[model samples]
Structures are given as C-alpha cells and as structure tokens.
Target: MSMSTSSMSAMSSAPSAFMTPASATSVLISGAGPTGLTLACLLARQGVAVRVIERAPQPHTGSRGKTLNARSLEVLADLGLAGDLLAEGRTGLPFRRYFDGAFAAESDPSADTPPTPGAPYPASLHLPQDRIEELLRARLAELGVAVEFGTELTGFEQDGERVTARLADGREVTAQYLVACDGGRSTVRKQLGVAFTGTGEPEPAMVVGDLELTGLEPTAWHQWFGPQGALMLCPFGEEGDRWQVQATPETGPDGTALAPSLEGFRRIIARHTGRDDIRVHAAGWLSSWRVNVRMAEQYRVGRVLLAGDAAHVHPTAGGLGMNTGIQDAWNLGWKLGYALSGRARSALLDSYSEERRPIAAWTLETSAAGMAAVREGARTPGVGLEAVRVADITGLSLGYRGSSLAEDLLGGPLRAGDRAPDARCTDAEGRPIRLLETFAGDRFTLLAFGHRPALDPAALDLSAHLRTVTVDTDDPAGLRDTDGHARRAYGIEGDALVLVRPDNHVALTAPRGGEKAVLDYLARL
Candidate 1:
C-alpha cells in the first residue's frame, strides 16, 4: 500500500504558505477524507481559494468505505473522474454464500436491474477507499491544491464574518468559512457544543481488516455462516490474493472480544469455514466495529460547518456511509462557491444544512433498519452476507423535493428539487453529447427544450453564473434529441425550460413563456 508518486509529490509540494495568521482562503477544510477532498475539488474548480488539512501523517491504507453507489458515480462523473474510476473498479460481482462447509447459494445483487439511457451507472463500484482518496488527491493537485497532512486543528472560533482557527503547531489561519470533515469524534463539532444524538450497539460486533489470504477464489465475494459465526472475504484490489475481511468477533471464555491479529483472523477463518488450508499471511487496517447511529443536530454553526462523518455516523450495512458523505460535500460545494463569489447571497448557505441534514437523518434510519434486518436474516438457514445488501442503495431516488430551492412552476413527474436526469443528444456537428457532460462544471446550467428561451441572461442577472443550452427536437441547428430520449426522460413534448443547479439538481422547471419564474427563483437565492 505505497503512496502513488503524484500523491507523494502533492503532499511534499504543499508548504506552510497557508499557516500564517494573515493567510486567507475562501474555504478552510479540516480533514482530507473523501468528504473534505470532494469539497476542495469542487471549490477549486470554481476558482475559490481552498485549503484541505488532514491530521493523519500519511494517506490511509485501509479498505474502508469500499463501494461508491450510482449517485456518487454521477457526482464524480460531473468532475470527470468516473472513467478512470470505472476502469480501476469492479462492478456487478455476484455474492457466493456457504453454510458450514457446504455451498448454499449464489445470487447477483443487481440481477434484474439493467442500465438505462438516462441512468447509465446503475451499479456500485467496489474499490478500496484509499485508492479513491488517491484519485481525489491527484485531481485536487491538478487544480493547484494539495492536502496538508499532519496539520491538526486544535481549536477554532468564528464570528459572523470570518473564522479564525488555531493549529496544533500554534499557527493561526483565517477563512471566510470553515468545514469539519473529521470523523465521528470531531473536534470542530465538539467545540461547537452541538449534540450528536443517537443509539449504539451494546458492544463491538465485528472485526474488520484487509488481508492477503489463500485457499479462496478471487472472482466473487465469499461468505460462510456456521456455528463458529459468520466470515466474509471479499475479493478486492488488483492483486489476486488481496481481500477485505469481516468476521464475527472471536471472544474469550468470559465473552470478552479479542483484539484483531493475523493469527486470530487466521483462526477465525479456519474455524468458521472449516477449511484447514485457508491462511492469512499479512493483515493491515485491523480494527473492531461497533454499530453507532448518530447525526449532528445542526450542520452549521455561524461561519463553521460540519459534514461527512463529522455530521453523522451510522451502521455500514448498506454501504451508505461514504457515499452519503461524498454527496454532502457535493451538495455543499456549489452553495459555498456561490456564497464566497458573491454570485448568490449568503442566505444560500443556509440551504446546505436544510437540504443535507434531512438526508443524513434518513441515512441513519435506513442503515439501522438494514442492520437489524441483516442480523435477523443471518439466523435463518439459507441467508448469508447477501442479507446485508439493501435495495435502492443507489440513492438516485433521494431528492430535495421539499426544499425551498425547489420551484415546481411547471408541474410534472420531473419536478424541481429532483435530480436532473441525463439524456443522449447530438450537437449541430452531429457529435454525441450527454446531458451530464453538458451540465458538468462550476456554473448553473439552463436546459431550454424545443427552442432557445427568449429570456436574456443579462436581464436575469445570471450572466456570470449560468450557462444555457438549447435543445431542438427536429432542427440540426443546435442540440438535437435524435432518439427522443431527452424529451422522454424529461416528460416534455413541447417547449420547456429546466434550471439546473451547479450540483446537478433541478432548481426550477418553467414553460416556454415562464421566463420570469426562473428569474424570480434565482433572485430568491
């Protein structure tokens, strides 16, 4: 698990330039995990000054939060990282289960689902979290920003206008806003005195680790459930022998949990699967997991904010933890960009907590329920690790339908506050284009269907923040919906307009003559 050359360079290249008391950035992010890095990437793309700090001395090598669902893929696709990620990750792998020493069942988790034109990424991608962080760090470096490792935030205080934070080294920095992407035990959140209320499992339930093991096939996720308890070894990484291991905790005669070790994991595997040949030669990232479901009561406190695990921590049953954090960063990135650049009023920042906190609440409940169902299913004779799999885990169905940002002026199934669905079309040159590609970048996108809207960008006061694309159904002059996929996906047979946020969520849906509605909605933000 060596760091990539580019990653090491990026780490070395980030000097203490932002460590001075007079130093200033639009956004100061604490923690360089997926959530913090995502926010940094988005802010950097918008030309906002951003600094990401990680307390860790080096990049994490653990295989934590190992799956990115369809929604997160779409979010990364907007950042132009999905192609490289898909090439490196595996998708649609079946789950193989065993009862004691005998094979029980095999099922494709995504058996019935097929990729549609609008939703091209229908499956989750399995890759190590450390590798994902490497990709994000490289992208951040390309944007002239690198994570400052080993820089811990000791304390912070914020006024109405700015936040000043003190580092462990006693250096102070100032920023328009500060974000905490630190894990569940967040210093920032703790200092804010925000209550993180939730329940926890009675005790540590499982031991998790990454190991190079033998006596198992590397094609599919293998699982065994027997009197010795459950053991799951998922094939991962480029190396064939590498696996992500999760096993029921091995306890002492007094029922006390044993610390995870190579020999201990080896014994657990052999006993659970009844396979004497299985051997665990090397192990990394060994740790115990206790189910804890909690979320911050508020996502914001004055000029400071909390995101990712800092705001919430839930059971990992549905593989929702990392994806949820990435989405939180995505949702907040554009709002922060607009607020900092004066494109939108600071009131726009309030919508970040409004829109994202509810999603975290839902995530806590959903993951807890999933954990309960899996525990119950494991007691049955036929069920295996597949019991932990949850349906609609893609998160595509989640939306901000109830948010104030949603303006359903033109009522239909494709309403505002919904994810702007992707569609296929051809440019005037007859080159292929996707709606997502067109929507990619740091500005709002206005998709005008059937014909170009008569509204003037300058008149709407969105000249700096908006990009409008005309979709023509019949003409070869602009974007042509040749196969009618765009029209069908949008449920529009005639002239219409959809205002998409920088985060790829719909803000307003207006008819051909409803230009004022779109303008008024932007005015509110």
Candidate 2:
C-alpha cells in the first residue's frame, strides 16, 4: 500500500491496550509549547496527521519569549499568523534606563533596523510566547488538530518501522516518528540517551512573571538599575495595562527555587525601584529563571528527534531561544510531511538535524555572551542588542552556506544555501509584489531571471509539487525585475536561475543553460 493509504489505515484503527485510538497519527509530538505547536500546526496544514501531548493540564501562561525578531516574524508570516500577531504586538518600543531614580540615557533599541524590500518585518516585536502558542493552537484547531493536554509522554521505544510511546494515562501510541519539544529537561532526550552537555550558571536565580500593575506607562520599556541588577518591566500587547516583570532578589545565595507569591513580588518591586506606591494588583503567571547553557550532542536518535528547548537551552540572552525553536519547527515540519507522504525519501528528514544543530550551537554561544555582558553590568537586562548586532539578533545573517543541499554559482553575493532576498518586482500584469508574497505557501519556487535561464518550464521534467515563475531580460514573462532590483539582489548580470526551497532559502543557483545542473541538485536533496 502507499504511504498515504497506510497513514489513513493507521488513523482508522480501533483502540486496544497495546495501541490506543490516538495511536493513528504519523508523527507524535511531545510538549505542546511553541515549538511542538508550530510543528504540529505545519504538519496538520499539509494534511499530515500529528498528535501533540503536553504534560501540563493547561497552556502555559508565562510571558517567556516576549520579543519576536525579524526572521521569526517571517516564519509567522508564512503561517498567515503575522497579521494577527502584528495586531497584537507592540513594535519599535524604546528602552529607557533609570539609576537611583534618575533618568539615564534612553536608547532606541531598533532604530538602526530599517525594513528592506525583501525583508519587511521589524527588528523585533513585543508579543509574549503564550500569545504565540495561542495562535498556533488556533491554527491547529482550524486543521482539526487539538493538543492533548494532561497527556504526558512517560517513555517511548523506537524501531526501524515505528515508534511506540507510553503516555502518563497508561495508553500506547504508535507513530512513524517521535519528536520531543519538551523543555530542557526532556524525557525523550533522556530516554534516547542523548548526552546534554553544558554548565548551569551559578548566579542567584532570578524571577520572571506577568502582573497587572498601576502607575507605569505601557509605552516605553522600563529598566531600573539596582544594587543587585537591572529590574525590568516590559509592557506587552495593547489589550490592557499588563506587564512582564523580571527581578532578582537580594536573598542570601541559597540554591533554591523562588516561590512566586504576592508578598515576594511586592517585596522585589519595592526593593528594586525603592517605590512603595506602585500597586501590584494581581499576578497572572510567575516562575523562576536561571542561566542554563546546554545543547544536545545529537538532534536525533533513531526514530526519536528533538526540537526547541528539548534540544537546546540558552540564558534567554539574545531572545533567540523561542525564535530559533520556531524556525526549527518550520524547517522540520514540511520535510517531515514530505517524508510521511512518500513524496520525498527519508533522507530529507535527515537534513532537519544536520541543518538545525549548528544553528542551535551558534545561538547558544551568542546568547551566552549576551548573558555574560548583562551579568557583568555592562548591559541592561532585556537590552542585549548592545552586545549583539542587528543582523544576528534578527536572525537574518544565518544561512546554510556549507549545507549539502546548496548548489552555488559564482555570480551574486547571495549563493546557493543563502536566504533568497526579497526585491520589488512586477508580475506579468505589471503589478508590483515582493519575493515574500511570491514564495508564500508550501511549494518549491523557481525564478528564472534575466536571459538564457538554467531551467525551462516547458521542456523540463520536474515534480508536480514544484512551482515555476519565469522572468525575461527584454521580453518579460511572468515576473520582471523592472528596475533591476532582482538583477542586483540575485546577482544576475546576463542570465541566472534561482530555486528556492519551501523554507525560503535558495536551494540551487546556476548559470544560463545549466538546466541539468539544477535538476541534479534537486535530485540530490
């Protein structure tokens, strides 16, 4: 039977002790955080059956990932959630610091970040991680997929054919693959015997929580310098007068988790700002946060794979922990879907680990450096951008240049494996559009720019899944670089062809008449 037929058969199976009713999905995901939710939502959109389970009875209410960078905005834009997210987010908010209740220098954190034709999102956005998960969950619901809350993956054993996972409710779920997005202390990673190697920062653990308080302007992001550290109170979303507070108490250096209580919160608020009048009315979520710098040695072990916090954890320095994980899901989701549907071989799934692992390692280092700068009093809390550049912080500078999937041509600065930059171009009707719009949806897009194109749509034999847009030099076809923006952005002097993968990265670029080269590159990936 075909893979889709087999997948349907699995979903239609009856319940039993060894395999339960929920055992039918092709991919089983653990931990319904942003990472798992994104992966689940992506797969579901592609008609891949996925079962997502979270140990917690309810969705997390904490505002952990408060900043969504530019690349993350692009990822969300791909899911059609960017418009709603932008509506619910605050943008280009300034960061102001006060020392001893006296105003220090105020800095526009994202002032230097200008939107480009290809990259339209802002430097960063102020939407909480909880809100992001809500969006993903809503998308999943639209696809008829609901997260299985209160269901935890106790353990799982995998083989060549399938993976059988045991839930906390004494149920068994058999799936073609298993992915763990369950935080840093991942049970799946542990069970798979993946070595998580890193050291935990011994600095006194800090507390972060969301609170509804009075007497603070929700416009400017505030930071108060204290004897211990900088106290942060960032306003998120325009819905109400809510804020996320991060502060460290002067309690003796005891290795203990701080309890999130009203009294404790008030005390920290009073101690840090030396103000007793600011009312701490009620708290929404509270938790302890510490610097744990770690990464899994391998992203996959057999049928079990890891993403998000399950695979790596940073000090929340560059605000990249959540964004990187979201990108990870975006990278893995479509590939897994193709593999599950048998449109692509299982080798495509291997690229998930190979591509994401290095990015995670780089994120860990950059975030670690940012954390060190903050702890050393050289930078303000939540203002690590002083140490990190705009490109790195926005995650646009990252590319799989050395990736085996890339095929480079010595024409433009952007080669194969580079992110295909956006440019203002016109379609056949002379209507202006950006590359982001053209590359929307889950399909490989081929752009034949300016001349003797490497690939031909009429004569070429290609997969039915591929999308082709032809651009001409003199007699323009479907797409045209009217003002030579495409020529400049894509490095097309006379003639060139660019093949962009589903994730918006250039898979292969070749000189004119290199049609066979492009085909060979596609076959290899």
Candidate 3:
C-alpha cells in the first residue's frame, strides 16, 4: 500500500521516527531557566512531548532578575504558581538611598494602586530569581517533565520537517521544533548564524550577587552613593540579611576592569557607606555582566527558534529580561501545541516571530532608556516607570495590539490583541470563579457577552475545541455578573462577542452578528 501525500506529510513529524516507542518529542528546549521551564511545562501539560536540557549540572542559586511585575505574576497565576509566590514574597520593599551614613530619599518600587475588578494582581513584587526558577521547576515536575542537567545542545541540523539536535554526550534527538532559551551566550543562536546586534557598554558592567550579611536590617532596600562609587543592597529570601549586593568595581590607575570578588564588594560597600558595622558573610553566586543591549536580527531560522535572553538582552532597569522571555514562551507554547496536534495549520507558527520580535525591540528601547535615566539621576523614560510611579514597570499595558491575529471590528477600551482582563464571578452552582480562571488551561475561550446583539448557542457548536462562556446568564456556561465587572470590562451594555486566544489575548471582538467571523477565524486556524 502507498501513503497519501497528506499522510506522508504527517509522518514527517511523527514521533515514531525517533526516541521511545511512544512518540517523537514534539518540542526540544535548550536551557533550564524560567523561560525554558515555563515553555516545557505548558507544552507538556498539553501532553506534547517536550524535553528540556540545561548545561548547568544543578539548579542555580543566584538572585538575578528579581522583580516579578504584575503582568509576570498574572502569567505565573495562569500557570497555577502565583499563589505560592505571592504568599512567599512581599510587595512592600521600599527603595532607600543613604549618603554619608544619613538617609536622603526613600521611594516605593511597587505601585500602591488598588486592585481593580479586571486585574487582581498587585503592580509589582520582589522575589529572588532562584526562588522563581525553583517554583517553575516544581511546576514542570508536576507535569512529569524534568530538566536534563549537564546535557547541552552541542549542535543540530534541521531539514524541511524536523530538527535533529546533537547532545553534548554525542547522542542525537530529533524533534519537530528546537527552542533556544539559553542565555546571552547562546550556542543554538550562534549555530543559527543569527546576529545579536546592538551597542554594548564600552566598560563591562560590575558584579551583582546575593550575600548573607550581619548588621543590616532587611527593613528597606539600602543604597549608599559616596565619593568612591555606589553600592546597593536589597534584602531577599524569606528572612535575614540575605540581600542582593550590586556595586561598581574599584578600578586601578591602569583603567583595567578588575574581576568581581567578595573582598571587592565588601571594600566598595565600606567605602560607600563609611560604616564598619555591616559584615559580609557566606557569599553566594557572583558574576559580572555588561547588559548587552542587543537583540537577534530575527527570532528564528527555520526549525530553530530563540526566546528569553537568547533573543534579546538588555539592562536590568525594568527587570523585563525574564518577563519578556516568559511571555515569549507563553505566546509560542499554545500555537506550537495546537499546530502539532493538527488543530491549527503549521503556518500559524510563523506568527511567533511576527508577534514577538517587535515587542522585544520595544523592550530594548525601554530598558536602555530606563537605565540611562537612572544613571543620570532622572525618572524612567516615558515608555518605562517613574521610580515613584513604578506601575509602568508592571507591564500591564504591553500587548500585541498590532498583531495580525488581532481583529478589531468593534473598537472599545479593550481591543483586539490587548490583554484580556479578568473579572470575578460565580459558576452555575453559584460557586466562586474568576474570569481568569475560566481562561486557564489549554483552550481558546469564546466570551459571549450578555448578548448586546443576542447570540444563540445553536449558532456555533465548537465545544470540542472551544470553551464558550456566556456572561450574564443565557446558557449553561453563563455567569451571573452581580457586580457587573465582566460587563464593564467587556463593554457588555449590549450584545457583543469576544474570542480570546489560548494565550489569553483578545483575537477578535465584533458585534453579535459577527458569529460567522468567529467561526471562520477558528476554521482558518
């Protein structure tokens, strides 16, 4: 018997071609950072075959990328990891500046705005990056996936259909896609010949790391800028003087960049604070980094794709490096899952670069500008936070308002490609539920508002793939909006329809008669 052309095409991506008898790995992720772990978990939860490999032999303990902005918390919540994070972390850490052992100014990095009906998470919170990674690794483990530590992607070759990755141990694994979540020095990116282009600080930035100390209270994030150089210490972890220390290195007369060390940090802190009381102990991970204000010329080269620091690296002013990468993973996870399962055409994968590349460019601009403003002792750029009004750092308004998938037939406050706001409501049993909860898991949510234009369920029967929820009680999935948050957020004064994508972004919003447009949109996907 001969195989049909379509059947042959399917066989090209069939898991049987490689690995165990079960199936070929659908996706292979490189690096075990938050970005890689989040992507691995999302795809694995959907029952997609995913394997994550990290060059590091064990989990890192560095407190790098420490800020979890509101949008990041929302993403974590969507993945079911937010509760533990919020409970373990505090949002009240204030930034304080001291000069010559006297306090000068104090400011709040986390916003103080009240939670709205549409958005529940606080504006910003501080949690160590190591803790966040541990949480993500825990979540990934729950999905029955583990990062293969000490395993590195030595090289790989991709053809028209599948990517074959060579492990450091000389083993080859084939998959439908290869995603590089590796850091600034990405081997996968280099192998792809993708140019990481932008300006790097002529002088390499100094070291920053976590240190267990004595005499300093964890009450406020302490910083001292004196005649020598500046050193900042922010308390981290659940307790004690487990603080992150960031300081400028003491350069000699030769103008050579000196290596970062505990002694160097202590000396610099002493010089800046002019205090002998603070004692540095048990020094944790320390490394120097010049934030490479660079981004990949493109996000992908055929079957190999880049996310996280692999795609872009910038200053830590907004702490957006990790958040952007996590967002990149989320955006790509659902599209890849559905496409691999044949729910959507493979071409849908092209949107990954289209939707994310421009956002990364904007992140570069915001981060660079923010860092510059901080150095010049000014507020953040108009695109970033104000130090006092740190809400912009939350990244709530960051959306793909210009993506091709976004269609705005009926324009309003929330347009196509905007982040779908959440609202509190109850299930049919009158049990408590949130709008964000409904959008959770792996399915597109079709929000049929209390029919400003009157939508009937018989009009569309896509239950097999779509989760339809009717706000204002007209059907089985209806929610009685007693507080009317859903109505207000969706502009539900009249009949309207909203189609949210699997990643919880508004894909289409139109009047009630636009049901066919919704049906047609899914059919095309």
Candidate 4:
C-alpha cells in the first residue's frame, strides 16, 4: 500500500512554471538506508511528496550497528514506530568492559538523566541496524512509498531553484531538494567537490561471521582486552545463542585487507577465547574496514544536502555512525516538510546544516579520541576508562548551542537549544504518562504553565499550523522528577513557560511575567 498512485504521479509530473524541471519534483532522496527511509517516512506522514532511490536491490540484512541510544528512541517514538521496534528488538543493559578476561567497569546508560522534559525511551536500546531499517521500510510501505532499488544516481545538475539528477538508467528526476544518504563513498558529495578530510588509524579489527555459540555463557556481552588486543563478544539474538565476535587482526598491514577465511577467523577466536574446539557456523559476512574520522566540509551546496555516512563517517568504536545519521534525518525531515509545503521560509532550511554539521564534527572527533584512548590503553581510575570512553561513542552526549532556537531567557527555567527530557506525569484524568507522550502527534507543542488563563493561541503560532498544550503545574519538583534532564537542559523554573518544537527542541522560554515574550517568539516562527 504505497501512497495513492495518482498523487505520486501528479507529484512526478512537470510543473507549469519555467523555473526548472527539477523544482517540479518535490523531494528526491538518494539511498534507502535508515536515513533516507526515515526522511521519506516522516515527509510522507506530513503529506509531503517524497521519493527514495537506492543502489542496492534490497535492504541489508546483516547486523551492522546494533546499538540505539536513548535520544534515537525518542526520535523513533515521535514517528510512532518505537513501540514496534522495541517489541522486535532487545534492550541490552549498558556495556560492561573487560580486561584480561576479568570484569573491569560497567557503563550505565541509566546513570545520565535525559536532558529534555517528558521524553520517552530515555534509555538506550540495543537493536541491530537491519531491524531498525526493516521497521522503517515497513512504515514507509504502509504510507504507500516504495523505494526505487537497483537504481543508481549517476550525476546531478543543480541550479538555484531545483536539482536535476541523471540516473544510471538514463532517466531524469527533478526535485526541489536532493538529499544524499549514499554512504561513505558518496557520489553526491564528490560531485559537489566536498572534501571529506580525516585521518585513518592503523587499528585492524575483524567482525566475525554469524556464529551460533555453544559453550560460552550468554548472560551478557564479554570483552577481552589482553596482550594480543581487544575481542568483544556480544549477543545478537534473544536466546543468547547467536553472537557477533570482533577481534583485532594478528597479521595485516595498513590498507591490507584481511582474508575472510574460516581458518583465519577461528585462529583469532582460539587465541582470545582459549578454545580451539569451538565449532564455527558458515561465516555470514566477514571483512575489515579502516577506522577513519572524517566529515564533509559542508553538508549542503545549493539544492543538494547530505546525511548519514555521506555527511560524516567515523570509527565504529562508539556505534555512533548510524544513530547520528538517524538524528540527521529527524532534524532535516521536518524542515523539508515545512519548506516543501510552502509553510516555511527557505532560510529555515539553512538551519539543518548549521545545527547538524557541528554535531557530526563532534561525533567524529569524540570517536577518534575514544579510539585513541583504547589504543593507548587508557584505563579509568577505578574500572577501565576505555569502556567508559567506548560508551561515550554512542553520541548521546551531543547538545545544541548558539542558535536562533536557543537564545535569551528571563530565567524562570527551561531555556532554548536544549534536548527536551521526558518525565512521568498525569493528565487531567490522573493517568500516568511521559512528557514525550504529549508530543506524539505531528505538530509543535507549546507547554504552558499556571492556571487556565486568558491567552490567544494564534499569537504563539510558529508556523501556519501548530499544536499547543497547556499543563498546569502543581509540583515543579514533581515535573522535574518526571523529566529532570529536560528541566535542567531547558532551564525550566517555576511558573515559567516553554515552547517545544515538534522534534523536541526547546524553541522558546519565558519568565513568569513574560507570556507576551513567548507569544512574540511563536509569531516569528
């Protein structure tokens, strides 16, 4: 059940104006990875015309990235797909580090509180990237949007108003916006002559094939850091049977590819696990990838924009690559929807690069730092600092600073440019709910404090259409208890007002007396 065929056909048809053939296409997204599929799904949900192209004939089934942070879960919840994903995926506890086959220190995700008020899925979820993409594809199909697979985006011609993409099959697709989710070796980024500058480390790691283990206990993930190197054995399935074993290679120079032979893989496993009799299943997919921390010089050039590995590619040390790409889609999805719908200014699209590029750079830098610490064998004071640093690779610590969204505050609490945290609260019926539950729908939320006072809703309209929610606070601390991270991140104090965008960023904040301040801010959006 794709989007109505007639509507899609109408969207594909050329416009009557002479601006450009590409501008006639609403939004054309390249690559059907999680980023492209997510952007497609969100835009389609908002009734925006969108199409996704992929070079692969089908979705990737291998277990690439298996960790999903709390912030990513919030984004999934916003799309109403978190429940389904959570049902199918396993939520592992924080990763535990090991040294010399002994327990080192454990990194607890629950330790850090969420930064936004009323955020759902505050805990990191452990799900394979393939599963997440599957869920996203299913969601996209339900919206009547099928990905055009086996189709390659050969080249593109971009003018001031639109982008004309030349497909490998000699077909021309014109789109108002061209998004490149085309992985690390992005043709789009190269065509734009965007330099991906970074250094590749000489650490050779081997991801073992899909193996069903027998002897090792399936209680938790096991990481062995010995004289040889680091070997991490993590559970990939529910019954704790199937596992993904990663070990540093014994013989391989820089740029030399490791042979994916079963003998070679078993030798490393025997060296680390101290078991030569362990049976090996048919190797699913085994290869070595260099660890490089790189980001595109710019995320956008004219009508072309970049996301996922195209914008930035970093070491898998922190499992941040996929999560960052997903977040990139979430940030760009709404902006594209608004702009294409003719409800937002073109300048609003600029914020996408402004806000996300810095975050990507930070992710690249942090991942490199964590890899350096691992190489240097930097151990924390108590447990191993390597594990703590490895845990940070998830990119959950990212936050936004210096943006129009985050500005002056009169100091009641809850400031702009903060990642909204979630808390447990009750509606008028006294039913318990999370703060993110209020923002389940596809609209902006204006969280108002105090009693049912006389206020004009239209004054707070940041867009032509917006959603507002007024929650009277009886216990400020109680609200914080529900979502302390959001309160502190936003600087929400007693009797203060807060405006949260659809994507959960604090758009406006005001003191108790400045209701007009909030009103005027919304009018500007």
Q: Find the candidate with the highest lDDT and give its number.
A: 1
lDDT value, residue 120 of candidate 3: 87
Ranking by lDDT: 1, 3, 2, 4
Each prediction's RMSD over C-alphas, in Å, is 6.5, 5.0, 5.4, 6.7
Tens-digit per-residue lDDT, 5-81, candidate 2:
32333334333465445455699999999889989988988889889999999988888888888888888888889
**For this target, which candidate reaches the highest TM-score against the unseen true structure?**
1
State the weakest 10-residue window (summed lDDT) of model 2. Answer: 1-10
lDDT of 3 by residue, 130-246 (tens): 899999999998989988999887777677888877765666788999999999899888877778899897775667888889888788888765544456788875466578888
**lDDT of the candidates, in the order given:** 0.85, 0.78, 0.79, 0.69
Model 3: lDDT of residue 232: 79
Give stretches of model 4 more than 4 Å off: 1-24, 94-122, 201-209, 252-257, 378-397, 453-464, 473-493, 513-516
TM-score of each: 0.94, 0.91, 0.91, 0.85
The deviation in Å at residue 451 for candidate 3 is 3.5
Better of 1 and 4 by lDDT: 1
Each model's total of backbone clashes: 0, 1, 5, 29
Q: Give the distance in Å from residue 475's predicted Cα in candidate 3 to where it truly belongs.
A: 2.8
